[model samples]
Target: MASNLPAPEGVEIQEQPTAGAWGEWNPTEDSVRPVRGKHRVAKQRGGLARSSTVLGVGVIAAVGASGIATAQDRPQVTISLPSLPDLMTGGDSGHGGAGDNGRQTDGGSDAEAGTAVRTGVIPRQSDHRADAGEVLRNRILQQAESQQGAAEAQARAEAERTAREAAAQEAKDKVEAARKAAEAAAAEAAAKAEQEAKEAREAAEAKAEQERLAQQSGSYSLPTSAYTLTSHYGDSGSMWSSGHHTGLDFAAPTGTPAKAVAAGKITSAGWSGAYGYRIVLELEDGTEVWYCHLSSMSVTSGSVAPGETIGRVGATGNVTGPHLHLEVRKGGSTIDPLAWLESKGLNV
Candidate 1:
């Protein structure tokens, strides 16, 4: 209590800071402000134990989260051991009363960390590196397989499209060919039908002409029926009276009936020398028709109509077998009966 004197220069004075106007200091949200980013400071020596523990925990967390393979090939690094006793005692022996006051100034922490890392404390890096390489290889192979599958699918689709197009074209071609063939067949059938129709028309016209002629020449008839002409008019023959035949000879069996050529009148009857049994008829036009060679006579006088039975065919003229010698005369001169009959629309 006497006059207080100043202590030595190295000694610190314990002075209590005053809580101004507040009775007992109790901390509250408004009483303290947390240190901002820029104002924060790292403790130098006293906080060694806490800093080492925090660093060790952070390293372990990093190693667990990402395998060693995630790190690139690099130089080895030092790591610290978090055992507090060894670290605290080592720092106490090395630095004096500062360590007792929870401050250690010695640099032993870096050496201890290096020793801990060198002693092979963590998991082996070689095994992790191999696992990482295998995983990378598998990923590459998977990607390649996926690409190949996509390529194959594209190729199959292209092939299917090409096949579909080809099939469509083939079907189109087949349809076109069928249409052309049908058209050609139809045209051929039409031409054949037209030709057949034309032939039918010509035949019908010919028949009509024949019918008209038959109707126009009423009562006209052949001199006889079922007769063969052995000699023709103007035919040179040794059996004829004039060395050349003067009439159309109608050969037939004896007693075969002979008819009138047309409506006519009987001019003469009976035989005349080599002219045998003969008859003469004069037509309405004064054209004379002579029927020589007769086996018998049914009507030897008076007028007669066409196709009336007049006599029988016989070998009567200057002749051979039974036959009718037919002659046409105009102006008392002989004419060819065959030609005259054709002009009158007779087929014979």
Candidate 2:
């Protein structure tokens, strides 16, 4: 700041400057450092820079708030900026002192103002800092809760899907198992039926073969052919010796064939007094069959099968006509010959 005051009465005025005088301002790192958050000024010259940063931010905020209020009421409006000199030199033409209210009178000199920038204007004030901080903290907590809820929902959905899949798999396995079980049961039933059928067929074939052998072997047969039953055992008759008949008589023509009733060996072949020219056939069960009044003997010895011809019918015994008198004896005792033959599956 160059002085325009006149030199005191030409006392060889010097161009050299004296003490406590301002110089041309060139900002340096020592005179001013960059302002960040808080309004701070260097001690080198009583903090002239403090007015710009804090005051500028406060003014911008106030203008912005007024603009919002004006737009709500009507439409957009512009605010003109102050002259650079007025802002820099901290002067308002309407006031007389530069101590306050962004005002200075008659361009007050630096010496009178005491600083290059006025420190009069105060920034907007807030009652407390915790209100803003608390709002931010609440927003953060709400965001965290929302994220956690979303994660829990996703986990529940995944669990439900997994459970459904597992249930479906279990049902499929049960169906497969049931199918296999049904197949096994069917196979077992078929095998059992087949085995039963096979056993039944074998039993039928065996029975048929047995019947065929019974026919071939002549298991039981009548004693003589072309005969009539003339006398029965236990008949009331006076035959001189016992007064009752002891044998059943089968009357036939002379020399008619007399056959063995069952398979046996010939035990006797000679005549007795009353049953003359008789033949005795002893069966395998030890029952003896007597063929009486035979005209001639054929199987007189050794073995003979059932229905084999062993003699011819005759009347050489007692007073009987041409007939076969058959008598059956068991355990050396006599049984009715007709009843014995009937018990052997023969109706004679």
lDDT of 2 by residue, 20-96 (tens): 56443333343234332222211112333324333433433454555532112221121112222333434333443
State each model's CA lDDT, in order: 0.66, 0.66
Q: What TM-score goes with each of the models? A: 0.39, 0.40
Task: Pick the TM-score winner.
Answer: 2
lDDT of 1 by residue, 82-197 (tens): 22223333333233324345443334543443344334343334665678689999999999999998899899899999999999999999999999999999999999999989
What residue pairs are clashing in model 1? none
Q: Alpha-carbon error at 292 in model 2, in Å?
A: 4.9
